[model samples]
Target: MTTGGIARQVVLRAAATAAGPALLLRRWTTADADALVEAYRDPVLRAWTRLGVPDAGAAVRWVEAQRTGWEGGGRLSFAVVEEEPGGGRVAGNVVLKRPEPAGPAGEVGYWTAAHARGRGVAPRALQVLTDWVFETFAGQGLEYLELMHQVDNTASCRVAEKAGYGFERVLPAVPPFPRDGHLHLRWATGGPVPG
Candidate 1:
């Protein structure tokens, strides 16, 4: 598989004015550490995603880890930033990791920032990421994507549904987490996966 050139230029569609500016899925940078630290401080985010950046230093480490993961293969991480005047805010993150290089599947994970929640950000960001991945990596052998969330996370389930991921089944005894979770699947369409 072509690892180095995985996501050279995968920009998603520009959002309509009524919705918002086009969502940009770019690689995380050190400048985003502060926002990431603040985003992880959200109680709801910590409770659900269990990710906590804690401080700017740790946030920088987290961002660096994501970059290393991309460089090492098997992972692709993007900051979900909304387009606005004078740059944009770090709204959230969407990541595809644990890729099966020789297989046709990968896992996706995401979380919306506290201030960005409830504005259709997560679902729309996920939709764009999913579409970009399937289209850009099709020739590299990617075929399907999988998303799993705590069964009790109704909001995440809704996001998966809105992003066109079909409910597959409940995966039991998932390691690192005790509770059973719902498994959602979205296969790559010839074009963008319809949401």
Candidate 2:
């Protein structure tokens, strides 16, 4: 999808992790439907995630939505996959969304499947996504990325920190969910990013 004046595809090599399988960040596909269904079966995932892709059919719609978003120049969604001997397993998802393409900023959001939790999947995938965004959109006016999570979600806090996004501020309660939220940010630098 086109964001902040740049357009590029998401491709990734295996990202090394502390434990478990290597991670790969790539565009979402309909083939990921079954995995999406299984991942959503986790109560934690269902409660935390905004999109409710509870079944294969719904997951297909979710993938189609991403494709539509990409074609319409809005959000870019990636499937976070873990590499194993037989093949890659869908571990979770990460998305970069820009409400205003003319703006110089965007928001990042992620979730890790139950099996992928505690294995550094979210942070590793987010780090790669952040790097790709800055590198691919360097001269296209993309300057900053932001992430928000419920203050009580300590795991998400850790993910933000591990991904090198500085905690910006704690936003007050907002709506039905995500009360006591914290805002995190990462600015583009010409050199290597920390995490």
Candidate 3:
């Protein structure tokens, strides 16, 4: 519930892809458990992230973890929702995680639901999240943002570049991730940040 006033400052911006629904970035809620689990059902998502949400109970825990992270002021995550007539549907998730509160940099992660892929959901949400991070944490000493994805994940590579996280270097293969990965970095103000 203590999300750096993010809950009160939701709706960072409204964006629409010429042919897609408007997008809104907000904090995760327990009510989103079902949707979260449903999105994770996609094999591609499960394969890449290795995060398996087998049921609503697991999804609730995942959401609760985000709340805990917020309260602890560590990882700030947003639920990317696409607006429709009846209501808003979750399109993706974006998160900015800082292991050290006053660290010079933080890491970012994101995923677009199967239904929302190819609709520009990942890049749009990531851009909003990156801007928010710089605006909200620059004064706290956060100077840069980093994004990493396996080299084989072309979709993620595109998302990283589209969001302006320029390639920094290659990361070593680690456990759970047998493949080498690419590290993309963006400075607080002077980097390849998109407009």
**Predicted structure with the largest lDDT when compared to the true one:** 3
Which order, best to worst by lDDT?
3, 2, 1
Q: Write the per-residue lDDT of candidate 3 for residues 19-82, one digit (tens) a residue.
A: 5788888889999999998999999999888678889999999999988888777788889999
- TM-scores, all models, native as reference: 0.89, 0.89, 0.92
Better of 1 and 3 by lDDT: 3
Q: After superposition, how far is residue 13 of candidate 3 from its true place, in Å?
A: 2.5
1-195 in candidate 1: lDDT tens per residue? 344666544455437345566677788889999899899888899888755799998998999898887887678888988888898888889988855666778889899898888787888888888877777677877778899998988999999998989999998866677688999998886334566
Q: Model 1, which residues run further than 4 Å from truth?
A: 1-3, 7-14, 17-19, 190-195
Clashes of 1: 0
Q: Name model 3 segments beyond 4 Å from true.
A: 1-9, 192-195
lDDT of each: 0.82, 0.83, 0.86
Residue 100 alpha-carbon offset, candidate 3, angstroms: 0.4
- Window of ten residues with lowest summed lDDT in model 1: 8-17
lDDT of 2: 0.83
Give, for candidate 3, the lowest lDDT window spanning 10 residues: 1-10
Give the candidate number with the greatest TM-score.
3
For model 2, how does the per-residue alpha-carbon lDDT over 1-195 read when each residue is reduced to its tens digit?
Answer: 554344656577555656877887888888888998899899998878776876788989988998887776678888988888888888888888977766788899999999888888888889888988788767767789999999889999999999999999999987766578999999887323577
